[model samples]
Target: MFYTTIFVIVPPFFLWRKKMKTEHLLEFVNVSMAFDDRQLFQNFNLTVDSNEVVGLTGQSGSGKSTLLRIAVDLVTPQSGEVYALDRPVKDWDPRELRRNVILVLQESQMFPNTVRDNLTWGLKIHGESIDDEALLKILEEVQLSSLDLDDDAFNLSGGEKQRIAIARAMMMNPKALLLDEPTAALDTESAIAVEEVLDELIKTHQIGILIVTHNVEQARRFTSRVVDIHAGSG
Candidate 1:
């Protein structure tokens, strides 16, 4: 009888450890979506492993960005389920969920204040206590050291603004990041800079990322897995 119990318990522990060691960080089970009765998707499944970069690609209006919104819980699906960090999204509190799952929209909004305020906004909203040193580190990571803390974000370049947006998402130490056309407005240099920072973050912090972009090269450059969305199940 003791041997039987031991065998059963040991296998379960080993399985748990195996799961923990792997990334399988985010999952979607038969996800579907619709807007105003227009069907966007049906029975779609996707999984993102930790430190894995996934690219979401499709033609214009193919619901690529909408898919990320659903994953981040900014929008609800008509059917199916989304789980982040292995927990049902609905089971987690909304405020706490926002902290864990950060999303950068196609057009990021900057507060009418200093660069410091914009970077710290999400952290403060999530009740995270961070010091100046930590803030500086994150800003430097995203190559925004040139922007003074007191300087108005209103005047920053498009690339600088986007980098700041990325920094805000990173400050939360999130399990995953949802990026929608993060570099759409940047020059070549700035776009490369943003991509480099993202690559560094993936290697150093093991943060899982789902980026929405129409640029096939960007998708090829960053993502380990590619999810292609086509028109009407094509």
Candidate 2:
């Protein structure tokens, strides 16, 4: 009786482990998209695993930002499929999907309110109560722990505002973060600071990250693997 139970439990446990090992956090399979008369992408394929950071680099209008949007379901491909957490994107609830796969845009959009208000906005929208501890942790993770909760969010500098925006997304506890030129607008020092925070977040949270950057050096420094999009590629 004991041997039979052990065999049944151990076999299923190993199978589950194998399944997890084989699945990606986000995947795009043979994706194709076009805008107006321009074909931006054709049969593009990419995968992001939970343990690695992937960078997208290309010239302007190469569809790097569009790819990130597709991962978050903000944009639909003309053909092919996007998978998140081993399931098709269509199978996810939109709100839940956004929470799990947060996208941080290049420009920081702030509410005309206090930092506390902006931080809690997503939680309120998702019907979850604000946890002060979690909020503080996220702030620290994004290198903005010095700012008071009641401080005016719109009064910060461009780089500070960017950090705050990243903190807001981190508050949601996403499984993956899709960043569109996260450090593009910042000065050298500020950009380096933000990159440090991003590196720490990936290590500490064990979440996958896909970053789109026009700077080849930045892409090489920040990500484990880089994907270059071209005009004619299948």
Candidate 3:
């Protein structure tokens, strides 16, 4: 009788452990946030997992961007829990956490240096380096072979800068990538090029993606699941 009880209890316990290990890369549980007099969302639930692309869509003030901010601790929610890499968001250092889970904004921020410095800066943050050959390959992947590594990053157009920002994030090899209107500023050809790179990341690295897009067609094409924050439920 004792052995039978032990066998039944042990299997379920181990199964629970396995389930926990597969938790979302970033998860918002009953999260709530507000700014000034406006309430952004309540009881919001979202899960971003490895090997999956999740789309986030809503109107301008629906707080889609804020959800991304909260994941990396940029903005704190008034209430609810946030988990990153299966641990509570507060458990990890903000900078270290951001390194593993990177966010690329719509409007890119340029470093005051050459494009080489911009791309290498990602590796430098982790005390690693990439040679010129590999750097050029990454550039070519993003359709910027024409731009020299020595070219000033600040001089690039808004759309070009966006691509650079994405390439920079790729250098870091984050476990999860949050992109906010990533291709909004690009032309049709450039947009498709960026999508190809993202698809590669998904297939090769099993990286989770949380993409916030206004274009319904883009959400359908890029994501396996879509969540509207205003609807306020999974």
**Best-matching candidate per TM-score:** 2
Per-residue lDDT tens digits of candidate 1, residues 12-38? 999888877754567878888889978
TM-score of 1: 0.87
Candidate 3 lDDT, 74-118, residue by residue in tens:
999999999998888888998788988999998889997999999
| Best-performing candidate as measured by lDDT | 3
Candidates in order have lDDT scores of 0.80, 0.85, 0.87
Each prediction's number of clashing residue pairs? 0, 0, 0
What does candidate 3 score in Cα RMSD to the true structure?
A: 3.4
What is the TM-score of candidate 3?
Answer: 0.86
Give the range where candidate 2 is weakest over 10 consecutive residues by summed lDDT: 225-234
Off by over 4 Å in 2: 1-19, 231-234
Candidate 1 backbone collisions, by pair: none
Please give, for residues 136-163, the per-residue lDDT of candidate 2 as tens digits: 8788888888988889999998888888
Angstrom error at residue 31, model 1: 0.7
Runs of candidate 1 exceeding 4 Å displacement: 1-23, 231-234
